[model samples]
Target chain A: MDKLRQHIEDITALSDEEYAYIKTFFTAKKVRKGQYLLSEGDDARYEYLVLSGIYKVFYIDEQGREFILQFAKENWWMSDYEAFFREKKATVFIECIDAGEVLVNTLQTREKLATEFHKMEHFYRAKLTNGYIALQQRIKLLLSSTPQERYETFSKMYPDLGQRLPKKIIAEYLGVSRETLSRLYSR
Target chain B: MDKLRQHIEDITALSDEEYAYIKTFFTAKKVRKGQYLLSEGDDARYEYLVLSGIYKVFYIDEQGREFILQFAKENWWMSDYEAFFREKKATVFIECIDAGEVLVNTLQTREKLATEFHKMEHFYRAKLTNGYIALQQRIKLLLSSTPQERYETFSKMYPDLGQRLPKKIIAEYLGVSRETLSRLYSR
Candidate 1:
């Protein structure tokens, strides 16, 4: 609950009574490495805020290739957002990369909190604003950057993720091969 | 302002009084073809909502190659959002392809409107949510799709944009050449 309060307060202040009410909407769960938090065609009913460890949100192509959308870390949120927001089946999968914990809440909780508290709405808006900016940067990089530039940009953007994850995973995220990542690393 | 009302009401309802107050924050501007609404290094202090016209939001690389971030059509909004939200100088250019009109608003106006009305906050959050989903799909397409597949997907996703835009620009958007796009069109 302290972590939740801290995360929310990072963007907007919440009174003690408000924080108490907000805490009731979230449920915490422990995750195991290699566990699937969400899978394609599942309900996609909930989004999780990482308390500890790492998770990757991705989708598998027709050829069974995985395209990583995002790697969520502590205080970060992850979900098949399109599905979650639309109340549809999950289109992407969220897999735990490291065993840890997450605070989970359903879309109902999100809407409820947002409706009940203007600060919560503002908090959500701020988070989305940052997420939108990051995604736009990703698009800009994809449109123009070379593999070397991609590696450098990714490293600069998510130094923590780059250090924690294997080169193979980084390559997938960069749309390059593991050997290519190895070469880049050496350079 | 009717169009603005319609657009906002599509997401959340607003009273006549609220619409009157909201409309005061936006200014109408006529755009000419070949005009630059925003350019790299300029202050991107405002976002434009297209009344009617086509504009390309893009950036040029060191090699003088252009990468388009998005096309703005009627009811669409465009800006160097990273700069717009962060109050930084523009890192991209927005050039008008077709002459038309737009309703413009500043970040301060946006904040004021959202803070004044809960429905306005909901309206903005909903728009950002959709934009987030759209950007995520773009990333997924960039991650795995081939040029041909990109063309098809682009067409499927934005049929109006495909129909309205020239093949050369579409090729640029798909990260392919005009000849490649022509070949795809034939197929």
Candidate 2:
């Protein structure tokens, strides 16, 4: 709860009462390695804040190839955001790669927090602003960087993630082949 | 001014005074075809709401390949969003592909609006929410869809875009080779 309190403050300064209100929405869960956190076609009932552990968020392509979209570690949030926000079926799979703990909150609970607390909405807006900035930067990186450059940058950005996940998964995230990732690593 | 009023109403219900306050900040501009609305390293001063014409937001890759990140038409907004919000130098480029009309507002103006009018923050929050949802869907599409599927989906999403731009540019936007785009078009 202390960490979650700090996380809420990191977005926008929250009042004690407001923080207490938000606390009611989040429930802590311990997930084991190789456990599935979310699967395709299911309604995304909750979004999770990874308290500890490595989690991969990926989608299966038409040819049944898995494409890793993101990895969430401690302090990071993971969920099929599209499904979670849009009230749609999940389009991605989230699996725990390392045993982890997360604070989970559902859409209804999140909305209630926003409606009941102005500070909460401010926090969410600020978070969405930063998320948009990150997504904008990622789109630029995908457009501008070569696969090797992207791989190098990814390794630098998520130092722990590179070591925790398989090269094949990183390759998919960087839009490259495993052989290409090997060559890049060798270089 | 009438169009601006209509646009605001389309997004959210605003009071007459609030609408007037917003209108005061925006200045309409006509952008000629082939003009660069924004350039790399420039101060991204304004966010433009497109009233007409096509604009491609893109960046040049290491190998000097141009990759299109987004194409904006009527009613869509374009800016080097990172720079506009952070008051930093722009990394992305926004160019007019046709003679364009837009209503432009600067960060300073937006800040004033947010500070003076609480409703403006709510309106901006709503805009950011839609943008967030769209971006999440785009990432999902990028991860799950093939280039051909992307092209088809993009065409469906913006039916007018295919007729407005050259095939090669659209191919770049879809992250496919020109040859592959030609084959997809044939099919």
TM-score of each: 0.98, 0.92
Query: What are the runs in model 1 whose C-alpha is more than 4 Å off?
Result: none
lDDT for B93 (candidate 1)? 95
Model 1 chain A poorest 10 in a row by lDDT: A176-185
Please tell me which predicted candidate would have the highest DockQ against the true structure.
1
List model 2 lDDT by residue over A82-148, tens digit each.
7897799998899998997999999898777765665666667777788788777776666567787
lDDT of 1 by residue, B35-97 (tens): 999999999999999999899988899999877888889998889999999999999999999
Instruction: Give the CA lDDT, 0 to 100, for residue B174 in model 1.
Output: 75
Poorest lDDT segment (10 consecutive residues) of candidate 2 chain A: A114-123
Give all candidates' CA lDDT scores: 0.91, 0.82
